[model samples]
Structures are given as structure tokens and as C-alpha cells.
Target: MSERITHRLVEVPGGRIHVAEQGAGPLVLLVHGFPESWYSWRRQLPALAAAGFRAAAIDVRGYGRSSRPPRVADYRLLAHVADNVAVVRALGESTAVVVGHDWGSPIAAATALIRPDLFRAVGLLSVPYAPRGPHRPTDGFAAMGGDEEFYVSYFQAPGRAEAEIEPDVRGWLAGFYASLSADTMGESAGESVSFVPRGGRLRDRFPKGVLPSWLTEADLEVYAGEFERTGLTGALNRYRNVDRDWEDLAAWDGATITQPALFAGGSLDPSTTWMAGAIEAFPRTLPNLTAAHILDDCGHWIQQERADEVNRLLTDWLRSLG
Candidate 1:
């Protein structure tokens, strides 16, 4: 059975954070990634709540009803880590299990990295928590990727990506989501430039078509509506701060996430292929990782695409943590 979800605004450091709450017990904070809201965790919320945990999916700063800082620098990883801490504190809990996906993965990991007192356990989906490299992460990207116009490199300049993507929000998001899913990229996936176009609009980088079954027309509209209201400034800003995040995390160089951790990703997710090295070494970086799962025939939208499996894995992990 599904638990009822409640929406509320909670006061935090910079501004109010909008959260979707359900159940009651130990707090479990869900932080969403770019181009998404708290709704990304819709499938997992009720499941966790029914499992006897207080589940709250948060709209990271700059997205959804959360505070949007005017400056891109304000979207730094530490800033996001602070937001997680604040939200946990606001919930009257000294510690909570923190779960994140996409960009939210690092934030959840960082919260566990810097303030384990607050985020007791960690759950990372899609993206793994790899330790910082010796140099700036962007510098490494430049060396490896060259002038390939990688999406992250393209997102460097403010307003560039927003200008390209925000115009046709529905089409852009639909294509973006589809391009990264198992439906589009399968088997021979790594060699395609379709995910990142060279000197072209984001829409040009993807095939023009209907959204996949995983993303219903209604789901697309909800995402489109949110981006329509806020534009892509805040969300894109996350990519903009990659280097800054690298520098900010320098103090904890070689530090590993010591909390009990679990990771889940789609077998066909591009990030899983790209971060193969890091994902393979996740056990080394996260020695406490209890389980790492890859769902077959799944895609980037793991929670939404394989909600039942994800819920089972997540709840099982949560249960083991007790």
C-alpha cells in the first residue's frame, strides 16, 4: 500500500525548501538532480513511508519551490550539502538517510562526506560517488574530451544552454530524457554523438519523437511546467560549478564516504558506461557500500523506469541498515 504524501515549505538557510513528505519515523531525505523536482522520488516515497520511515523528497536549491540563488556560484556542491543539512535539522532530526540521483548523488555523498553526523546513511542512484581527482575535474575533462562540445563543457557559460534548451521546454526535455534512456541508447551506445551535439542546439543533439512510456505525457508536462516557470538557470548552474566543487572538496582529498551506502543504476544508462571505472571502484571509495545494483533493460530514469525493482532494493537496503 502507498502512504499519503504531503507537500510543505520548510524554512532553511538561504530560503524556504519545498518537500514532499510521507510516513513517520526516522527521517529519510531524498534530494533530486538537475531538470527535476521532488517528484522524481514519487515512486520511492510511499514505499519508504510504508516501511516505517519518514520519507521526504526535496527540491534542491534553485529548482522547484526551493530557494533560487541569483548567482551561479551559490549553486556550489557545498551549498547543496548545506541545504541537505538544513532540511534534516529543520525536520528535527540530527541524522537522516540521504538519497540522491543524477547531480543529487554527489550532494548526498558530500553530505555524508563532510557531515556524517547529519546524513547517517547514503543512497546514490545512477551516479556514483567517486572521490575527487588530483586536479580540477574540468581540466581532466578538457584533456580527455578535447573540443568535443561535451554537454558539461557546453554548460560552462551562463545562459548558453538555457537559451538553447528553454525555448521548447517539452521537446528539449523529451529528447534529453529519451536520448539517455535504454529505449534510445542500447548495446552500441557509447560511440554516439547524439547525446551531445557539436555547436548545435540541445534539441539537435537528440532524435525528434514522442517521449518514452517511462515518461508519460503528464510527466513531461510537469517537468516542462517547472522549467517554464524557473527557466534553466538554476538547474544548469549545477554543471557550471563542477570545477568549483572540485576545489571546495580539496580538503577532503582521498576521503571516502564511510557511511553505509547503496547504489542502483540502469544497465543501459550512459553514465553507467561512462563512469564504469569509478563505479567498479565504488567499493574501494565507499568501503561501507552494502549493495550495488544494476537493473537490466533500464535507463537513466531508474527510479521512474524500474520503480518496483528500485523500491524493493531501496527498502531492502533501508531495512538492513536498521
Candidate 2:
């Protein structure tokens, strides 16, 4: 199944983007989130392909083989949306159905929201859609952490996280992934991975030893190798731009995605719980929502943790879009 997938670099504005694609039919562009690459969609590529759709996943700039711009501002949401648009154009297609997981969820939603003509429909996993609002993102994050610093706030300083991650990318990645998975997350129940104590590192709360059921040693190696080569700066930069994204997207404040859409989140995922209000307001935000689901006992890594179910829901939704 893996052999059927092909990889290539498509030229975008700042640099070339690496893309892995499979199958053939209506284009379904898959975008990854923080600390991950195109490989995160390894399962979906083959599944979507076999199900009769062209599935293409990309290293969302700053990860994998994609070009990582030197400046932090380069990783803003608008740039990511532009990259998605360019990738679709470079593929020789005028439009595509975009699906995103984790941070990719926002990127995909922004793409669909900003360019409805190009992205006909969208599927968001792990993260729900919430349009820009009154508060600055950093201010909101700061308030969320209370005494402890939110992980997003911890990533603001340029070299802070890189110093922690670069030393042992593979080991760090193992703990990070485990901390977010349903199986091993209980090890750090009192110490949330999402928040960093005043002087402590985020990895301090991450579980050690066991890998999540969905992640194998090889899977860990793929993610670690990419970050090891590229470093965490590019990926972390996405966090640094939240305020900028909020400011840049203000024109669309309180906007709704009018296009057909689908959302699937893990019951155990903190993102779902934290943004439950957004999900409840789907009727107002995603007026054309096709389906919304919360997979039982799942965690942050939605598509990866529950591949079969997610694949079924995605394919059904994609087919419904016809």
C-alpha cells in the first residue's frame, strides 16, 4: 500500500513544498499540524486512494522536505493558506477538498474560509473551527494558563523550545506523542502536557517508556528524523504567530464557513473539550456542516488514533459532497 504513494516538490512562493500523493479522482489535499509532516497521513493516503479519491499530503512548510523560512513571521496563517492554494494550483487543479488535523485544522479552515472558490469543502480533525474574536490570542493563552504558562506561550521565545528539543529529537518526540495519546496520557494526568509550569519544560509532563498504540518505533523515527534535520524552530514558529494571525484575520471576525464541512474529534482530546462551545455553535459558525462526530475514547491524534473510523467518515463525507 505504501509503495503506491509518490512524493514530489511543488514550487510555492518562498520555496518548494514536499507532497506525497496517491490514488486518482477529485483532489483531497491533506495538511498536517505542529511537529509532524506529510508522513502523518500515511494511513489516509492509501485509504483515500483505494476509496477512489486522489489523496495528497504535504509537509506544511517548516517540516519534512518543505522549505523552512528563516523568519518567524513567515509561518503566519495567511502564508499557510497561500501555500495550500499554490499546491492545488501546482497540481494542475483549480480546486480541492482540504482536510486538516491538529494545527492543520485551522490552516485548512482558513484556506476554506479565505478561498471558498478553491476549497469546495473541508474536513477538520482534532481542532474545531472558531473564527477570530475580540481577544488577542496570546492574551487568551496567558489567561488560560493562570499560574502555569500555556505551551503556546512557552513557544513564544525564539530559542526556548529549540534548546529543549534539538538535543534528542527522537526521544522528545516519543514523549510528546505519548503524552497526547489515549493509552499513555494517564501517566501525566496531574501534570497536563498542554501547560508548562513556571520554569519547567513541556516535556517534563510528557510520559516516557511506552509508545502509543497508534505509533510504532518506525513511525516515531520518521517524525524524529524530520525534526532532527529541520529542527523545531520552523514548527514552533506557528505558535509564535497566533497574535499575528488574529490581527491579520480580523476582517473576517465572527465569520462562518458557508461551504459544506465535516468535523471529527476525539472524546479525550483536550482541544474538543476546550472548544466545546465552538462545536455547539456549529449551526452558526459552520452553517453548512455536513456531519460532526466525537470518536469514543480517542485522543488528540484523531486520524492516526482512529484510522478506520475516520477514514470511513471522511470517505462518506467526500462522497456526499458529490
Candidate 3:
């Protein structure tokens, strides 16, 4: 079954961040990603809360019921890392288990590294660790992509990506990844009652863009509502800062996370797998990553699609530590 979660807003560094919580023990601070709200963790919040850990899911800066700052830079990695620190501190916990998915994973990891004092451990859901401390904008562009997948390059292309996805707000963003099938990219159209990544025209052994089939209409609605409110600018802003973050993180040394780290990936989820080879960079940077697991059957939304397994894996990992 799923856990029933509760929502509320709390004040943060720049402004107020909407946070949802349930149960009580230590603390599990969940930061949501782009086009997603605290509601994303609907299944985990109550489960963890009941498990004795105060499950707190906070909407990132510019999504959902949280404050949306017009300035794109406000959503930068540094600002985001600071938000995690501020949220954990604001919650009155010296350190809490921080979990994040998609864009939230990056902030979660950075918080573990830069503000280890404020975090007990970090769980990176889909997007794995990318060791580009001082990232160059040039280093983070569409290294090799096609027209089907645009946001990566589209986000930076003046004002194009966001505009394109606005058509069927729910479908556009949901379709971004829900269009892929068990075999090919964007081919299984109008079959599944839910969403799948498709529509891009391409023919290669690796069809550049492939969305898994976990995002459903209801799921897409949750995401579309947020994008409609935020207009994808604040969310897309994450990509724009590639060049600036590299320079900033490279200069900071004390932020290396040496705590017990866990990396969970969906073998089918291309996001993490895309550059997952970079996982080697993490142990070198943190050195204490105790375990890493790959759900060969799951995808980007592992926590959502494969929640039972994810929860079992997450809970077991947490237990093993003690």
C-alpha cells in the first residue's frame, strides 16, 4: 500500500518552501524535483513516518505550493544546496537523512558534501552523481542528442524549450520520459493507458531519447500543474548554470561527502545510466560509499514505479547501517 502524506509551508533562506510531513523518529527530508511537488513522495511519506522517521517532503524553490522566485539563478545548485541546509536547520534537526530524485538528487548530494554537518546520509534516486564541481557550460551541452529530446538544448536556446512543452502541459512534460517502451524509443504509441516517451524522429541502435512507461495520466497531471504555474523557466534554469557551478564547486574542498552513500539506479532509466560511468568519480571524492544497487527492471521513477522494491531497498540499507 501507500502512505498518506500531509502538506504545509515553511520559511526558508530566500522565501517560504512548502513542506509535507508525517510520523516521527529522526528525520527524512525529501526534496522534490522539477515539474514535481511534495506530492511526488505520496507513497513514501506516510510509510517512513509510520516507520518512526519524520518524513518531510519539501517542494523545491519554484515548484508546487512553494515560493517561485522569478530569478533563474535562485534555483542554481549553490542556492539549492543552501536551501537543503536551510530546510534541515529550519526543521530543528542537526542532521537528517536527505533523499532526492531527478534534479533534487544533485542538491541532496551537494548538501551531503558541503553541509555534511546538516545531513545524516543522502539517497540519490534517478540522477546519479555528476562530478563536475566547477562545471563549464560548454562541458554540459547536448553532447550528442536529437530533435525528439529538446529541453536539454532547448532550455538554453533563448526561450524555446519551455514554449514547446506548454502545448499539452500535462502530456508534453509527462511524455518527455513516459514514451519509451521495453524495447524501442517513442514507438509504442496510443497503447498503454498511461504516458510514454516518444514523438522524436530518429533511428539508431540507441535512439537518443527514450522515456520509460511509469508516468501515468494522474502522475502527469501532478507534474503538468506545476509546469503550468512555473512555466518551465525556473526548472530549466538548472541547465543554464552548468558553466558557473563547475567553477564554484572546484574551489570548495571541505564539501567532499565521506558519509555512507547509496546510489540506486534503474538500468532502463537513461538519465543516470547516460553518464553513470562517472560513478567512479564519487568514491574518489567521498571515499565512504558503502553500497550501490541497480534495479535492472526499473527506470527514472524507480521510487514511484517500483516503490515497494525501492522502499525495501531503502529501509534495508538504512537498517544495515545500524
Q: Which one wins on TM-score?
A: 2
Question: Each model's C-alpha lDDT?
Answer: 0.84, 0.91, 0.67
Q: What lDDT tens digits, residue by residue, belong to model 3 across residues 236-277?
A: 777776556666677564355677878787777666556566
- Report clash pairs, candidate 2: none
- Model 2 / residue 217 / CA error / Å: 0.6
Show model 1 residue runs off by greater than 4 Å: 1-3, 186-195
Error of 2 at 106 (Å): 0.4
Backbone clashes, each candidate: 0, 0, 13
Please report, as a residue range, the 10-residue window in candidate 1 with the lowest summed lDDT. Answer: 186-195
lDDT per residue for candidate 2 within 141-259, as digits (tens), equals 88989889989899999999989889989988888888888888875742389999999888888877879999999999889878878889999999999999999998999999999
TM-score winner, 1 or 2? 2
TM-score for candidate 2, please give it.
0.98
TM-score against native, each model = 0.95, 0.98, 0.83
- lDDT-sorted candidate list, best first: 2, 1, 3
In what order do the candidates fall by TM-score, top score first?
2, 1, 3
